[model samples]
Target chain A: MTDESDGNPIERTGDEPPDGAPPGGGQRDRGDPGASDRELAADGGLSAGAETDSEPRIAFYGGKWASTIPLAFFILWAIFQSGVLGIGDTNGLVIGALVGTILGMFFARGDWKTYADTIFEGMTQRVAATAIVAWLWAGMFADTLQVGGFVEGLIFAADALNVGAATFPAAAFVLCGLLATGIGTGYGATIAFVTLFFPAGVLIGANPVLLFAAILSGAVFGDNLAPVSDTTIVSAVTQDADIGGVVASRFKYAIAAAIPAFVAYLIMGSMLSGASLEGSAALRETATALGLVHLLSMGVVIATAIAGRHIVEAISWGLVVAVAFNLVFGLSSVSDILVFTVTEAGAFTSLPFVAVGETASVGGSLYSGATGFFPLIVLTLLIVSMAQIMIRGGGFAAIQEFLLNSVATNVRRAELTMVLGTATINGMITINTAAEIAIAPYIARIGEKFNINGYRRANILDANTSALGYIFPWAGGVLVGYQVMVGPEGLGAEYGPEMVVNPIEVVPYVFHGWFLVIVFLIAAVTGFGREYIPDRTSEEVSRA
Target chain B: MSRFDKFFAGLSFRGSTPDYDPGDVIEVMVTGEEGGEVVARIGDSTLRIEDAPADAVNTRVLVAIDTWDEAGHRGTGTYRETVGKSAF
Candidate 1:
């Protein structure tokens, strides 16, 4: 085994330098008694011969470069295969994966012997671990809360507000945003609210496109700032900051943009107010009854997260508390809740089961709660793994070093680089969670250089990634929202594909996303909310 | 030997010593192959020396480095490494 040491030469750990340091500090001169002119000139004039005259350039088209070729090829292939070029929509991810792998081979500079080992190293690194654990725990917590009636409670609460039909869109935006933040899964929030709140808004005569856009906007808001969010986790880890530090710093910036976008939604809602529908009374009563039972679930998540517990432990406690609430309130039987947890939306088969020789009918609450997140869980795993591959292959590093060397000159430029880099990655991948992980290291590195606070970096990283994820047509969040609007028994009759605010169409209505981008840019230029920034001292990063 | 060589050779021997004056602002121009150029500033240091990347640049204006105290605990200090003209 190679001897590993920490960054300090004094603290020897076997032999390897700490995480980021090069082992043995590269080649050292053994027997140089005098400071010869050639030696001094070659070694950048350092007596110890520790420094080199020229900066080490990453040899392009090397083994690292080879690994990333496949990903690029896959993107191009996916565009063609998905009929995104007009043929027919194929599985773009599959195409991307296949192409990315093939390209990896050609760009690989080293011989075949080390290829497998390098790939393995890339996959098993700490970077992958952060994304995997954060996503899974957040997924489980989101799922459990949904099965525990969190959405029903929210809907019930919304109903009781007696919010006008015209104003429902704005209210839905805020409600969805809150739900996404609490649950830490924007896609899951999108699906749940789109099914529950969007339908309700439509029944009450709210514009379907406007209502859906509001839901999408809220999902973006929560996804961008939630402490438990996968994007946030990736951003913090990559940037070498603690999750708490990241969240605390980003809060002001997120709120700055969110508040204004919210007001605009309200104004638009009022201007668009027209007709009314029936069933406000039932919706209100049902919501009020369920609201009290489930409110504690959100509280548990926020409180434990703030307390700085490990994410998995925090969410586990949240799940337990939610389940306990279900039991205490007699809201639903344990069996019913368990069944609802695993069922998917839009699938049903009535089954008769004999319990103690008594025939009981079982109906699937397939569209009910948490089960909706199963697909997202799978997607997160694949995307994160892909990100791991990218990182290990050195593509991520290549991009990061490029950004650091170019663009990240001062504090303001560094911030802009963070925002633009995160947004660009999100737009290309159409997956915010994965994009956040991919871009996080650069954000942290650049932020650290300028002593830009950790929170500011995290906020920019998360918000930009979240915003761009929904702006792209193929992004998971947009797809879910679009599906909800066009599904059978959906608002298709009133607003078909042409009118149903496709992800591209919703970009104009995605006031929150645009607002966030603008706000972040403004902050970057003006340094408006720079006070809360945390200097990512090396100690903090190593511990992190 | 040239003055530049003598100075750098001396600074290299004192591994952790500050080579640059405190609060001296130096401009570092980092050129990339394809990306373009990036320039940064270094703030101040307590040590004395000249022309080394670490000495010429400002630590406060650049990246922060985490260091270890004598007790083997972690502490943060300004980073000293500065890239000149070419940073690949």
Candidate 2:
């Protein structure tokens, strides 16, 4: 590669990357000029001529190619545990993290003290701190609404519309999109709509398979666009963008894709829905005004965040309002607000704690709201610590150098690479959030070089991240949806085998996912939404 | 070529040569000495200023771009006392 970078290499008196030093350790022949140049960039000196006179010591690889250990272990573990073993993401990450750290210790060159400090440094990195705090607040607020009947309110609204079989599928897309956006969990929306709305849609002569795909498409939209979504949160924090900025910036692309998907659903609904839904009209539950009240709570959070209040404070306000609304509006009682009732209590049998019986339950909207994110919280923190090691060891920097050199020669190519790379990762992984976390750092490092706005990079990362996971057959979303279609035993006995939709059948109908990918591709090549750095400082748009 | 392609063709970054408009203000860090010339680095590109204050070698300073060659990505600048980069 030509050093198009103007100016002579700084005559480094010291601290320059030795000619053959690779971040992974071990010697290269120094014969390959391209490899040596990349090593220099990744070595943290960054400049051809070394400046600043100081660079942090990185070690433990012992000339055996060690810096790549953490990333290698984590990626392999994610593939095996999630992709192969079909294990939960949280469990796999914890195990992968612990094992990776242990391996880092064995391969690391320095004393135990340095390794321990590195772990601490990584854990407290600004990105991790920013994301963990945001997720905590977002989780609590989301949980509060879910408990206070957000889903039920949406269902009530859908029922009252009483659209024909031809319109029911379109209604399903809109309702499921609202529910998932409000709740910030596409899987939850999938399950709720599949079990509740799916049967209802079928009675109206809505095509079951199309309805299922519509629900999934709605989920892709929500997951891609929702402010409170885990994938959205991860993408923003990793790219040094604020959640509010990311949500606002990505909205155009999301709506552009969704319009086409909605039209497709309407067309499909008309052609496929032939059965009569006459008798099921008797099955309407009174839609509660209280269930709809949670919309105000969601608005409060989004409004406060956009106005530039601290995220922690914004979420706290939303949580408080939600709990209050549940109580004051007669949506939930005091017990439902927060409770510890012992049905069979043993641990809290003493006087300080009260038990209903030998066992006790500790739950309420508040409890579930906050605790719902415990697994993900731990997952985020652990992965960040592991990421910190990779960064300091130049693992990320090496990849950064290669990306800039081999393919992303300019802004357009860089953005396209981000979209394609995120898509490939999400396609192979069964769990969407795991895929997001795995690819986020690379996106951040590569995107930074072109001065692409954090929001733009984050949008690209999340859109493709959510799109692939729900469309692929091995994806957890697709599998779970298929299982639901097949009924309780996966035998399709309850709905009858004919009603069951194969995962492949739904793939073509996942219109929103495909459209989202295309919108981002256009955004990348055209620089439609690109914003360069320092145009607005972090204080204006980010806490990270 | 399409106008759309031409419209987006000029943007590039992550360069070793310091890129700045002729009248742009930039942030630079002074790092080392090269034969009595004070070398400063900006945006990952380093060049010898030929003549700089002795004390300026280890400090971040502001500059006004006097000239630039886009293909070379190299430029010369005189110092500005006010510092520019934010805490973020």
Candidate 3:
């Protein structure tokens, strides 16, 4: 790791500060709409201590790096709460961030107004807003597909294909990967698959541990490649690349790893079936082919997104297609898609999507999908705000300068730093998207210094995030999958103690995740799939 | 690029230090000022940009490569016009 003890080497002249500084130190420039820390510092009318011609950089008691106190404290909190305690509560993370930001204020050299104003400034960034909008839309579309019986459809397909115990793990991997890719949330996919496919695969004689690994491998695949995935969105937006181009550019890496992972699953599935159960044909009675039609919805989103339509437009179209399919095919009812219920029946209650129920509440796939991301959205904004504080305090510049001047002296080392930096951060944080966001600015700075294109930078950032997120025992994906196995509503209720797969046992067998990391390591060293900034430019990032 | 072509793009091995030929026009984000001259660092390759705008750092500009030294992976270019601004 590069040392932060040194001061920022990027000297700020009296004429102009860096990208995120006020155009003129302490100048209140309302017309400049730059979204970085500069826009915030400039647009925020608060006078930063004495309003001098020189750059009004906020200094900490120790140095510029001390300005990183808030983010550093939050990282430590995340390490303890998610890594050590293994509690992946985003709300708890939000509290940690709030405390960190507040704590950082005491260390500022001058007026606290600049530090406080930086919070509001950071929160208003387009990067954070873009990610939140993408997540909400993706969540709604994914939930709609899930509610439409996508998992059941996969089960039906597996059954129809007559995938025996010897092939179940491989089949499960492919099917679960497709579901996760469509839904864009590996955690949701893990829970759903563990609840349905895990038991089914086990009862059909597939090895429990290998089956679990297959599920996680599939999730890694989707998390890395899916256009609508939160990690994908963060990687793309933070690196200033379009979601469609990012997805398309990353397909090669995902597929290269997936092929070998699928083969390993097939070979291991057959050899590890020594503990196979007697029942081979037992399957969920609800499995049906009609649910498979959601494939078209997923295809529409991917196609439209890759064709350069706006992400909001693409996902909105996908949501429309999914809702239509659910209605026409009777996959789900109108009330299931969206429902507003009241305690008492009224004239409006007769509306197709409204109902009278015991409690007054809104329910349905759309509601749940959007609501699920609420905590993450809050966490993202807070983290970005914290990051902005670092930028203003020169902590960010100090670290970047240190890395560029010392460790990442050449293009090769720069690429490697990007890969390893992302990997190390993701290894500690349970939530991959959160980790990706925290490290994104560093990756962007390092990559752009050498003119590494947005797509390559985004690919490197996301590959590690997606890979490590499912590999470690404390990872959010593994914990969610484990929770499903042990929960009363899941496999533990029906299959009892023997069905649960220990999280540690599945780590080595997560073939896709490991392969993805390996692919990136090789790519970084070999310059495979690398693109210079002038090599290409993606479509403009459309703010939602 | 077409949607289909995007998936196949970047399939080959790129070099850490790429090469540029004279008269090759390209758009690049000016990385920074070095020795009071605008420079664009593309991978390990460096191009000294001549006649660039004063505020060229972090801004995208079109340039015509005038001279290139393959051994050192360095080149000189004449700045054309600013094409874009930084993204945050």
lDDT of each: 0.54, 0.64, 0.80
Among all candidates shown, the one with the greatest TM-score: 3
Candidate 1, residues A171-215: lDDT per residue as tens digits? 999889888988888988998897777767766778666777788
* TM-scores, one per candidate: 0.70, 0.76, 0.90
Q: Name the DockQ score for candidate 1.
A: 0.03
The TM-score between candidate 2 and the true structure equals 0.76
Better of 1 and 2 by lDDT: 2
- lDDT-wise, the better of 1 and 3 is 3
What does candidate 3's lDDT look like per residue over A326-407, in tens digits?
Answer: 9999999899989999999988988989999999999899999999999989998898888878877767766776677778
Better of 1 and 2 by TM-score: 2
Give the Å error, residue A51, model 3: 15
Error of 3 at B65 (Å): 0.6
Candidate 2, superposed: residue stretches over 4 Å from native: A1-4, A7-66, A85-89, A103-117, A272-283, A286-290, A343-358, A474-501, A534-544, B1-88
Candidate 1 ranges with C-alpha deviation above 4 Å: A1-67, A77-95, A273-288, A337-401, A488-501, A531-544, B1-88
Poorest stretch of ten by lDDT in candidate 2 chain B? B1-10
lDDT of 2 at A490: 40
Candidate 2 residue A192 Cα shift, in angstroms, is 3.2
